[model samples]
Target: MPQRPLARALTALVAVLTAAVGAVAVPGAAQAAAAVNYVALGDSYSSGVGAGPYDLSTCLRSEKSYAPLWAAANRVTSFKFPACGGAVTSDVIDSQVSALSIGTTLVTITIGGNDAGFADVITSCRFGSTSSCTDAVNEAKAFATGELPGRLDRTYAAIRDRAPNARLIVLGYPRLFETGSCGLLAMSTYKRTILNEAADLLASVTAGRAAAAGATFADTRPYFAGHGVCAAAPWIRDVSGVIEAYHPNADGYRYGYLPALTAVTG
Candidate 1:
């Protein structure tokens, strides 16, 4: 894939300039036609880590990432995709400030997965016995219950301060559980339980936090609900798409984020 462009920042210069006194302007003397300035800020799930047709080398950014997909679908004019792999909530606080320019109309974030260390949970579930899966669920919940809110608060505050005017949308994690039905892999009962628990944690934490922030939180779990391990039309089919055990698939870009597009743009 082509070298990733410097993550674009939203800028409202046109609005500022046009409003200034004694500014000579176009004949229409009209407000500038503001195209949606969208910035996607988050981690691997947001970056489409394993969901690639494999194009870019650096940052391992996926071309099929929801950001590009949404942009094309909506005819978005300005877009910045800074989402990379391994982003924690703290990373969101650090990088998202300058990511927006001036006319930023929309922002979508998918983060907090790494904080849960979901990959390790999967490994423990896959390699260990039923008891290990129970341990994983508890450990995962500890993050969601104990740490997710704090991380979410910081992330929300940072985004709000950085792009106060944009319509921010927080996304929940996708359902990656395989409860004895995935044709791809006979995911152990423990493994499925852990995966579902992780998804639940992410959803509850993000949904509550985003609501507090007055941002839209799109819950994708429902979209993928019936399609879990036992369902025939599973939302996410790729194993590694689990990103060590429970993230979305390239199909997730379709299943998981389209609703986000509708919500944010609406």
Candidate 2:
């Protein structure tokens, strides 16, 4: 119906005010979300020690590492790889945490194994007598239960302080041996059993500390089942070299560690 001029003017003004109110009600809805800034930090495991074709020789940073693979797959805004081989919790607190910042949205780490003297324990188990292997594993287990937690707490706290908003995922080591006999070269079943127990202890300690720090724990043990050093299709490398021995191979990173991480992140 034909309305008065004043009435039509008032109706137009009301429509404009309603549109203004709607704009004020929702803020930044039209703006895009922030991009993911991922920073990978920790020891060789995080640095991709076993995953070869390294991009950085010093840290053994490999393109095949779960960090890079995830970053590429997710198309993160930034990816920082500062994790070095043989890095302990101290090394991470001292050197690695520098890569993180408030903008970092995701962080992943595998540490505390070195602090527990992983290399020495493996060496003792491989070459020493069963008694020596047991002793070494016992000592490592003791240290892991005693001192490693504090170190991990410090490291995790440092990471949180640096990247306060990041979702930190702490990846754990798997049992290295499958037990039983695979060949003469394989260590004794007794040694294998103890070592697996030690790995379990470390995982427990690390998981507890991660929980204390409000971080997610990614356990790779399940994924690496039936894929230890003496398994038919082992993901962990046998003592082929000095550096790579007792470490996860490329396949381990791809199939085991990567999936474990993905499960937790999702």
Best candidate (score: lDDT)? 2
Off by over 4 Å in 2: 1-33
TM-score for all predictions? 0.79, 0.88
Query: Could you give me the TM-score of model 1 versus the true structure?
Result: 0.79
Cα lDDT tens digits for candidate 2, 1-266: 46688898999999999999999866665433557888888888888888798773688888887788888877788998888888988889888899999899899999988899988998999999998999999999999989999999999999999999999999999999898677887888898899999999999999999999999999999999999999999999888978888888989989999999989876
Clashing pairs in 2: none
Q: Report every candidate's CA lDDT.
A: 0.73, 0.89
Instruction: Mark the 10 consecutive residues where model 1 has the least summed lDDT.
Output: 1-10
Error of 1 at 9 (Å): 56
lDDT of 1 by residue, 96-154 (tens): 55797557878998888778877677677766777887787788888888888888888
The clash count for each model shown is 11, 0
Runs off by more than 4 Å, candidate 1: 1-33, 54-58, 178-185, 229-231, 237-245
